[model samples]
Target: MIIDESLPGKEECVGSLKNILDALYVLNGKWKLALILCLVQSSKRFNEIQNEITGISSKILAKELKDLELNDFIKRNVYPTTPVSIIYEATEYALTLKNVIGELSAWGEQHREKVKQSMRKQS
Candidate 1:
């Protein structure tokens, strides 16, 4: 999907391809979509996210959160209270993704079922 100079008068098509790549740049990870779903459930602190998203290393979670924040998909609120505290919540932009994520999850489930049926038939 690399855009090249040969595609003359195709700036519009190139733009569309660029847009899709930008999207995949953010949501192109095993953990990112799941992390978004978890955040959709409720606003949470760093430790809370790490706990709820079992097996996620602190470093990886931090990277994912940073990526989401950069993508304008989540907001990080810092409280200047005791010991300093922060909470991450889905932004309005992120909220818009709820329906999309739901549909994707359903599709994944159905795909899994189909795969299982195929496996069973082969066995």
Candidate 2:
């Protein structure tokens, strides 16, 4: 069997690709990153999170929080008060993504400018 010299060995390439895909699968929604960012600043109750993230619905927020919790990206706490309160806080694992988020933000700004330039040329 002939191996493709143009590409890295299958084990190396596939393993890295699989890891990236798995990460994307876990963090795949529009809201997950936003939610993580919000929680990075401080722990917040469910309603507080919902209020901060303008477009997220109650059901979606609930689902996203559960997903984050499952991934160990956030910690959920229960407070026994007159009414029980649930709070979500970003875990240290989530803070590891700070550089990733910062790079994405910088790239996004660059992309926005690129789009604006293209539109200007078209008009």
Candidate 3:
């Protein structure tokens, strides 16, 4: 089959698609980004993170924390103490997502406003 020389090559398209897939594989799901955003703001204990994010169960939070730690996005520090305090903090690597998170936050706000306007118009 002949190919269009003006268009992007198959290899280029595949590479881009692979990159997107890799990103989604790491960052997909409702709670991962939110959890990262929370830790980026401040290191917190498990209960504190759950309280800040709201509605995330203990089980899910534990899993997400482990996932982020494995991905090198967060550092889980365990202090040697009677209660064994553990604080979760965003790592420098996780800071790489700051711009992405900011843009997503802006888009979310704009989308919410747009939907509200559409609903009001319909009413």
> Taking the tens digit of each residue's C-alpha lDDT, what string does model 1 give over 1-123?
757656546888898889889778889886888888888899999999999999999999999999999998889999999999999998888888788798887897879988788989999
Q: Please write out the lDDT profile of model 3 over residues 54-95, one tens digit for every residue.
A: 889999999999999999999999999998999999999999
Quick one: best lDDT, which candidate? 3
Cα lDDT of model 2 by residue, 29-82, tens digit: 989999999999999999899999999999999999999999999999998977
Better of 1 and 2 by TM-score: 2
Q: What TM-score goes with each of the models?
A: 0.74, 0.80, 0.82
Q: Sorted on TM-score, highest at the top, how do the candidates line up?
A: 3, 2, 1
lDDT of 3: 0.93
Query: Least accurate stretch of 10 residues (summed lDDT) in model 3?
Result: 1-10
Every model: Cα RMSD to truth: 6.9, 5.8, 5.7
TM-score of 2: 0.80
Best-performing candidate as measured by TM-score:
3
Q: 41, model 2: CA deviation in Å?
A: 0.8
Q: How big is the RMSD of model 1? A: 6.9
